[model samples]
Target: MRDQDVEPFFATLQAANPSPETELEYTSVFELLAAVLLSAQATDAGVNKATRRLFPVAGTPQAILDLGLERLEESIRTIGLYRTKARNLLATCRILVDQHGGEVPRTRDALEALPGVGRKTANVVLNVAFGEATMAVDTHIFRVSNRTGLAPGKDPLEVEHKLLERVPAKYLHDAHHWLILHGRYVCVARLPQCWRCAVRAYCDYEPKTPPPGDRAG
Candidate 1:
């Protein structure tokens, strides 16, 4: 949490995974945008499963628009809130075709204007697709930020802002990915795997969780 510890904390993460990436599968910015939109309240694995089939059939804004609402719904029905997601995707495709010339807009305002796209989704697209140093504080990032005393805040926006301010500029671009992956695999909500954490030495959390078999008898 200290000014100095922040750098090494992220350095440790970066060392472990040199190139962190979003688990959501996509080949284009448009597909990534749609995948992030559908990923709300859903797992990356689930989204990938649905998108795997959906993308091949309708990967682009125009292709998805041509797929029609009924068929789109059927294609992504395996994901949670598929009906709503389908409707939003359809509307978003229309906007992309009409306003953005079938391209995923790079600006935050334009990206957020799309149906189903929120600040978090926009941040992800901006960071991953455009290499912008933005943080998309999802449940995983939120939990990791607070639990590790990295950038404790009451809400995602606060955490995001704090992370941007606190994290060293050199690590800003990949900070979100590193923290998200760490939270997803190590600093889990139910029980953080502190025993094997790479940055455990820098973490301010008290009474770190022990290895499974090392629990007090």
Candidate 2:
């Protein structure tokens, strides 16, 4: 999309939902980290289903360590790659407790040092938990960025940098959330629901799909 349209595009999204948030449920920074770590290749709804049961019992780093590996695996078994995620979470908790006094770190370097916490996961934690203007370019965000012509790039890191450079400062902090939500519900991988999209006017996608009733038989 043109630089001129960027502001209005975000403005439209902000007007539709002023306070967008991550779909993953969490009440604390640590819990948020855990949820994001477990969310790889899994749906937010699925992670929520498992975390709803796990967090209550072992919400803290120490408590999660105390829960032990076997039980931790059992708690999140419903999610894909449970064994690997469980190991990573436990290792991360160990680092949090042993190195950071059981508190989630604030810096990108520190956050990514933990197992299962890559650049994208670190970005999400930094943005959602610490109010940083970092973009966690997930599948949804990646698709939306390229599809909308907002910040197209060959890779997520490239897209992230493009977004950081292109997005206005006022919308930088929450831009990822808006894009993710739009991609998830409207500008999906399949035929985009452009007919009802609020920001369809600003999007660069061509030959916008018509509503079912309007499609040619």
Candidate 3:
């Protein structure tokens, strides 16, 4: 995409939703980081459902440590990879308590050092928690980026780097939210809802999904 296209793309997205935010439900950065970690291979609704109860009782690192791995696992066992996620979350909380004064770290290195916190998870935490301009390339963003020619790349890291360079400064902060929402609702994996897409005009995708019952209108 061109420089001009970058600005207009974000303009349309921003116009549709003036204040976009991550769907992951959390009251604090620690909660947000924990939520993102558990969200891997899981849906927002699933993560929210699990965290709603967990956060109230044990959101902080010390609190989570108190909850213990067994209880934590039971809380989020409803979601996939719950066992692994529980272990990672517990370990991460321990690290945060011992190393970072029980606070969620702002730097990527610090965040990534936590168990289960990968590049994508760190990016999400950094962007949402710290207002950093980082892109978390999930399946939805990966598909949308390549399909729309927004920042086409074979891998998530490649797409993330390209997006960092190409995405305009004005849109950098909210790019993750906008793209995730768009990919989740409009530019879907199976059948894109082209009719409802707000940025369809700027999208460079060929053979766009036809409107329902169009009869070649």
Candidate 4:
């Protein structure tokens, strides 16, 4: 996509939803971090379902650490890879309590050092929790960026960097949320809903898919 089209493309998305936010439910940075950690290979709805029960019981690092591993596993067992995620969360909580005084670190290096946190998780925490202008290129964003020719790249990191470089600075803070929501709801992997896309005019995807009823029988 040309530099000129980038701003309007994002402007269209911004206009449709003035304030985009992560679907994952959380009241604190630690909770958000843990939710994102558990969200790997899981849906936001699923994570929220589990956390809805889990958070009220133990929302903080210290509280979660006090919850113990066995109970924590049981709490989040509804999520995929719950055992692994539980273990990572426990270790992460320990680190938060020991190293950071039960606080979620703001720095990328410190955040990534947590057991379950990765680059994407760190980026999400940085952007949403701290209001940093960072992109967390999940599968949804990855697909949207490439399919729309917004920032085509072979991998998430490449797409992330390209998006940061290409997206208008004014929209950088919420760009990830907009792109991820668009990909999840509109530019889906199986069949993009190009017929009703807000930015369809700017998209470079060829032979855009028509609505289901419009398809040939």
Candidate 5:
């Protein structure tokens, strides 16, 4: 999309959903971190299902460590790659407890140092937990960024950089949530529901798909 169109595109999104948030259910920063860790290659709904069961029993870093590897694995076994994620969670908990005094780290470097935490995960924690203007580009954001001509890039990092530079400062903090929700429910991967997209007027996607059974509209 043209640089000029970027504002309205986001403006439209903001107007539709003024207060977008991550779908993953969490009551605290640590819970948010764990939920994002478990969310890899899995749906928010799926992650929530497991976390709903796990967090109440073991939400804090110390509680999780005390839960032990075997039990942690069993708790999140419903998610994909449960064993690796369990090990990573336990290891990360140890670091948080031993190094950070059981509190989630605030800096990107500190957050990334934990096991199972990568650039994307760090970005999410920084943005959502700490209110930073960071973008955690996922498959949905990648698709929406490219598909909408919003901030197209070959990789998530590139897209993230572009978005940071291009997105209006006013919308930067919440842009990530808007894009993800748009891609998830409106500009879907299979066939974009353009006919009903709130920002269709500002989008760059052409020949917008019409309502069902009316592709030529």
Candidate 6:
């Protein structure tokens, strides 16, 4: 999408849902960090469901460390890669308590240095917790950006860069949430709901999905 189309695009999305937030639930930076780590390859609802019980008693590094790996495994066992996630969580917590004063580090290097915290995880923390304008290109954002011609790119990193450059400053903070939600509900992977899409007219996707038996030449 061009610079001129940026305003109306976000305006329409924002009007629909005035306040979009990450589905992941957490009380503090530590809980948010831990939640994002466990959320890899998992749904926000699932992560929230598991963390809801876990955070009350053991949200911080020291608290989670006290709970031990076995208990942590039990808490998040329902999520995919639970075993691996459990190990990473324990190790990361230990490092945080020992090295970072049990706080979520602000810099990407420090955040990524923690076990299980990759670019995407760090990006989410940076944006949601620190109010950074960074975009974390997940499967949902990836599809929506490319499909809608908002910021097409070959890979997640490229897409993120393009979005940062293309997205207007006013809407930069919530762009990730908007795009992800749009993909999850409207511009879906298998069959985009073109008819109901808010920015359907602005999209550059040619030969857009048509209604059944409504093919065009």
Q: Best by lDDT, which number?
A: 2
Q: Which has the better lDDT: candidate 3, or candidate 6?
A: 3
Off by over 4 Å in 1: none
Summarize candidate 3's per-residue lDDT along 92-151 as a digit string, tens digits: 999999999999888999888899999999999888888888999999999999998899
RMSD of each: 0.8, 0.7, 1.6, 0.7, 1.3, 2.1
Candidate 4 C-alpha lDDT tens digits along 117-145: 99999999999999999999999999999
lDDT, candidate 1, 56-168, per-residue tens: 99999999999999999999999999999999999999999999999999999999999999999999999999999999999999999998899999999999999999999
The worst-scoring run of ten residues by lDDT in candidate 1 lies at: 1-10
Q: What is the TM-score of each candidate against the true structure?
A: 0.98, 0.98, 0.96, 0.98, 0.97, 0.94
Return the clash pairs for model 6, or none: none
Model 1 gets an lDDT of 0.95
Compared to the true structure, candidate 5 yields what TM-score?
0.97
* lDDT score, candidate 6, position 167: 87
Please write out the lDDT profile of model 5 over residues 32-99, one tens digit for every residue: 99999999999999999999999999999999999999999999999999999999999999999999
- Mind giving the per-residue lDDT tens digits that candidate 6 earns over 44-99? 99999999889998989999999999999999998899999999999999999999
1 or 6, greater by TM-score: 1
Better of 3 and 6 by TM-score: 3
